[model samples]
Target: MRDSFHHRLDVLVLQLARMCDLTAVAMSRATDSLATGDARLAEGVVADDVIVNQTRTRIEQDAQTLLALQSPVARDLRVIVTVLRSAEHVERMGDLAHHVALAVLRRHPDPVLPAPLRSRFQLMGSIAVRMAGTTGKVVRERDPVLVRTLDAADAEMNELHRSLFQVIGHRWAFGIPAAVDASLLSRYYERFADHAVAVAARTAFIETGTPALI
Candidate 1:
């Protein structure tokens, strides 16, 4: 029974990694759609969200089942709890990516970001993708040192998010509509990074038993 429980735990980790993989793909295509005015890629991300949502549901159910059946205590219990919470964080990352895609669809023929803000958004998207990829690895390995890098990357992402406001501030030539779109897109990237950080923090918690400030 103990070996069976451990096997299920390993399976849970793999499932979480799969969900992270989906999020990374969603965010990557979302940025591409945002950058190139490609409505098709944006639509594809929106369609893929159903899978993300389903994965989250499955993860949560499996965690609950393990809790009921295994009656795990101490470290084993912590691992299951972290898996449950991290799944929600990953699901939110997917939703943030979906929101970015929706913005692209809304402005289909027209590009959502102004010329001045395009490069900034691209960087933010890159950071988001990197953070998400790292998050998946952290979930699998639970390496404390590996998780700390996510904190550094998230700080960089926050700075980029802050800098975007300067461009979108007063003396804006693109008008109100563009400003709104840029603001929302910047926020999406920021929150996407935040969720990635949250998942990493949860992975850290599994081993350290210390909750992260994030």
Candidate 2:
């Protein structure tokens, strides 16, 4: 019974990790679609949002089951708690992707980012992808050190976000509609990165037994 129960818990963790990967892939694709002005890709990303949400719901249900059945303790309990929280963050990340896809579809029946801003958004997407990748690793390996590296990555994201604002405010002169769209897109991307950092912080806490906020 104990062995079977432990196996169930293991399955729960793996499922949660898979959900993160799916969410990351969706976000990466969404951002790429935006950068490249690929309407097809944007449509695909938007379609995948439902699957991501389902995966998140499944993870939450599984976590609740494990908690009720296994009665995990100490480190085990922490792992379950982290899984629950991480799943929520992952779902939100997926939602961010959907938001980007909708923005692309709305702004560009044939969407293309302004040339100057493309590279910056691309870099921000890269950071978000890296965060998702790192969080997956931390979950699988329980590596506190990798989580710390994710913290450093978050710093770079902040710098990029600041640079984006400076560039947009000074370099481009857009009409009101374009300006509003650009601003909202930038904010969404930055906030997505922030949530990724939060996931990494929680992973680090689970691994290191320290709740050091990043």
Candidate 3:
């Protein structure tokens, strides 16, 4: 019974890792769709979000079952609890990515980002992708070192987010609609990175018993 419980716990972790990978890919593709104005790619991100949601539900149910049946103690208990919270963050990341893609889908042939801001949005997307990748690594490895690195990555995201505001502050040629879109785009990416950082922080807490400062 003990071995069975451990095996189930390992499976739960694997499921969480899989969810991270899916979320990361969704963000990458959503960003690409945004940059290129590809409706098909944007649709793909929207469709795949169902999978992310289902996975989150499964993880939650499994965690609850483990708690009821196995009554995990100590680190095992921490792992189950952390997985529940991390899954929530990961799912939210997917939703944010979906919103980015939805903007592209709404605009269709027209680019969501104005020409002047395309490069900025591209950089924001790149940073978001990197953060998502780092999140997956943190989940799988649970290395405290990698967890600490999320702070630096999140800082870069903040800087990029602020730059978007600066672009909007000056007399913008893109007008109010474009400015609104740009603001929404920036928020989506920023929130995406924030969730990734949260996942890393949760992993750090699980491993070290010290909560991340955020």
Best by lDDT: 1
| Candidate 3 residue 137 C-alpha distance from true site, Å | 0.9
Models ranked on TM-score = 1, 3, 2
**Which digits, one per residue and each the tens of the lDDT, describe model 2 over residues 1-214?**
5697667767877887777687779879988988888888999999999998998888889888889887888778887888788788878888988998998888776554666778888888888887877777776776767867877888887788677667667757655566676677777777777777777678677757787464
TM-score per prediction, in order, is 0.96, 0.91, 0.96
Candidate 3 per-residue lDDT, tens place, 81-192, comes to: 8898889999999999999999999988998888888888888888888888888888888887886787887888899888888889998888798899989889999999
Looking at candidate 3, the ten consecutive residues that score lowest on lDDT are 205-214
What lDDT does the true structure give each of the candidates?
Answer: 0.90, 0.79, 0.88
- Screening candidate 2 with a backbone cut-off below 3 angstroms (N, C-alpha, C), the clashing residue pairs are none
- After superposition on all C-alphas, the RMSD of every candidate to the true structure, in Å, is 1.4, 2.0, 1.5
Residue 22 accuracy (lDDT) in model 2: 79
Candidate 3 TM-score to native: 0.96
Model 3 stretches astray by more than 4 angstroms: none
- In model 2, where is the ten-residue run with the lowest total lDDT? 107-116
Q: Would you list the rank order by lDDT, best first?
A: 1, 3, 2
- True-structure lDDT of candidate 2: 0.79
